[model samples]
Target: MIFVPLPYVVALLLAILLIQMVRRSDGNKPNLFFAALIAVYALQSLVIGTRWGYDIVALLPVQAILAAIIPALAWLSFEGLRDGRSPRNRPLLLLHALPALMILAFVAFWPMPISLALIVIFLGYGSALTWLAWLGPNALGSSRLDGVGNAYRALQITAFAILGSGFIDVIISLDFAETGGTHSGGIVAIGNVLALLILGTSATVAGTSQPASEDDGSGNEIPSPVPSAEDARIAASLDELMQTRSLHRDVDLNLNRLARKMGLSTRQVSGAVNRVKAMSVSQYVNDFRVKEACRLLANTDDPITRIIFDAGF
Candidate 1:
């Protein structure tokens, strides 16, 4: 009988996900980063299966480097959704790659502390991602409002998966220390495969929150100017515009398009809505949509399905 390892199965699933993402991509940076992350996870799973199942000792370093990369990519993919800033504008993005580069350096000369470094990297990124998610859907200012909640939940799941992987590493290390590496194979086979699968799936789900635009100039570093009288004015203008033009009825209405229509930056519009309405931009627009839907349902004899579509739901 031929035997197939669990990681190989995971690798195959992730590969399919990567292909799907690539095919569906709208040339968005978040989508591209998500595809790259899935591809990396698939590659890592393949390397793990080969090394553990086939006893391919030569692949150990490759596995280590890839493991280091997974968390970094996950972080970048989600971070890109929070604001539509491109990679070039975010200089700190290069810092995220340091962990993987360190792993590579360790692979070359000093391999002893590689496991410890990986644990730190995983836990650190996991915590950061968890915090980002904890900030709620509003934190992903650039994300499409319709899918922001799902993206936030996906971030939480991915964070937990990354943290779980770190804990699994701890368990495997303890197993090796206590049992002379006897049960490490089974633990790695099961624990890693599960973690990577969850991570990949959650990441794909998070990627669903596409940004409104790639270059809306919403830099994460710059603080949104404090709410002022101008914010109230902008909010009032936006309200008038939405009522007059029924912009909320457009199913594709997003921060970028709305801001462009108003002749303002996304930050200006989002900040105005957030300040004046005490809600996210999506919530504010969605309130108008909900109200319109209610009015239509009460007055018009339109079919419920048609009402939903007409209300931009």
Candidate 2:
């Protein structure tokens, strides 16, 4: 069946790729939450594509994954957005787990009422996650955030919306299984739109243009950019600064000075740094240097200021 395309597919794909990139970029430690997200998506595809989807009993794994994945992700996504507070609504999150376990356990023994209950629970999470996902973009305008985080967040939100919508629509499918009348009309329409949202978000979340192994600054090796006039200058200057062996020795490298040395448009330079390196130029330069200084402070006879300078303060 044909599914319309939308922005959500891009988001979905990005959500998958972002964590993997972050993992590779930072260290080999993969995020279980993000990895689980990828599995949930694959299972969703499997359920939708195969004949096993029609058989709820055979779809136990799919349903179980959907139930567990959405709520946990919703909570985690919310935490990331809010910068991880102590989790005030612990009870609410737990309630979500209960319904999932209930569905999983009962499905093994009972099918009818348990299926209806599962459908209802799915609808609830579907509606909630979808709303939260769409809500993030509206609050954080597409133009406001830096490219990497914005793209990652956008994908996160869009995927939740699409998959969430799919869950809700599927619930309605169950509700209208027998009659398939006027009540089903709304569900069908909603399902179609949700399907498109899923497609778009999925593409972005995956970052499929590059293989899983490569990470050459685009975060995905989609071929190095041509290095526009602005980027070329910034890259050259940064390379020069790094090679100087003295500049990196300083710990307090000012953005204004760097801006002056590069002589390119500061805005372009900043954007390039963010998109290419995932950090502001000042941060890119100073943070690691600071860490080095701290290490020197603890381990050597270097004076604080000397260490700071050595670290490129």
Candidate 3:
């Protein structure tokens, strides 16, 4: 009788998810990053299963490096969703990679601190993601309005999963200290599988909500100007455009596309909507969609499903 390890089963599931993501990818950076993150999780699961189940002593460094990469990739994938672009600048990219590089350094010359470093990396990135999610769906200004809610929820789940991974590490560390690693195997087997599954699934959902764009080059960090006459004019122009052109009917519409139609940067459009409407761009557009759906439901005999599609929901 062959006893199959749980992580191997998890790796198989993650591989399926990775393949699905790759097949569905539209060459968008966020999608690709998400796919890579899933791939890494699959590989890490396989490595963990082998190392623990089969006692493969040679895979320790490989597992450490891969573990380090997961949190960084998760951060980059979600950050891209928020910024509407991957980190293209060399400096920014390097800064994001610093934590993983440090882990690699520890793995190479100083293995004692490897576990501590990983715990720190996971907890730090998890906290960062939590903060991003706490800012609300508006923070993901690049996601399609119709899907922003799901993306926000996915971000929240991923944040919690990452934080859970950190806590798992703490538990394993405590177990090793108190019991001489007696319970580490059981903990890793169950804890890691659950964490990877949650992280991978949530990331896949978030990727589907990402807009297909290389870069809008809009800096979201800049302070939004107070609602002024200029903002009112921009909001009026946007409203006129949406009403006249029925841009809300486009199911794929996103902030970048709306801004392009208005001949303004995404920041300008989002800021104007935020200031004048006192709502995120997504909520503002979704309001239009809801109204259209309601009108159709009241006046037409179309199926609810058809009306939903027509409303771009």
- C-alpha RMSD for every candidate: 6.8, 13.3, 6.5
Model 3 TM-score (2 dp): 0.76
Badly placed stretches (over 4 Å) of model 3 are 26-30, 200-235, 244-246, 249-251, 256-313
Q: What is the lDDT of candidate 2?
A: 0.50
Ranking by TM-score: 3, 1, 2
Q: List lDDT for all candidates, in order.
A: 0.79, 0.50, 0.79
Indicate the TM-score of model 1: 0.75
> Positional deviation of 29 in candidate 1, in angstroms?
6.4
Task: Kindly report which residue pairs in candidate 1 clash with one another.
Answer: none
Ranking by lDDT: 3, 1, 2
Give TM per candidate. Answer: 0.75, 0.42, 0.76
lDDT of 3 by residue, 69-145 (tens): 88888887778776576556434777877877888888888899988888999999999999988776657767777
- Model 3 / residue 299 / CA error / Å: 15
User: What's the lDDT of the predicted structure labeled candidate 3?
Assistant: 0.79
**Taking the tens digit of each residue's C-alpha lDDT, what string does model 2 give over 1-313?**
8643332343355465555557654454343444555555545544443422243346555555464555555444433333222336444545546765776666667755654565565556556555555543222221212222343454565446545654664666566676754454455345545654664455455443322223312233333444567665676667667667545564334434455566654455555665555554544555456667778988999778787656654
**Candidate 1 lDDT (Cα, whole model)?**
0.79
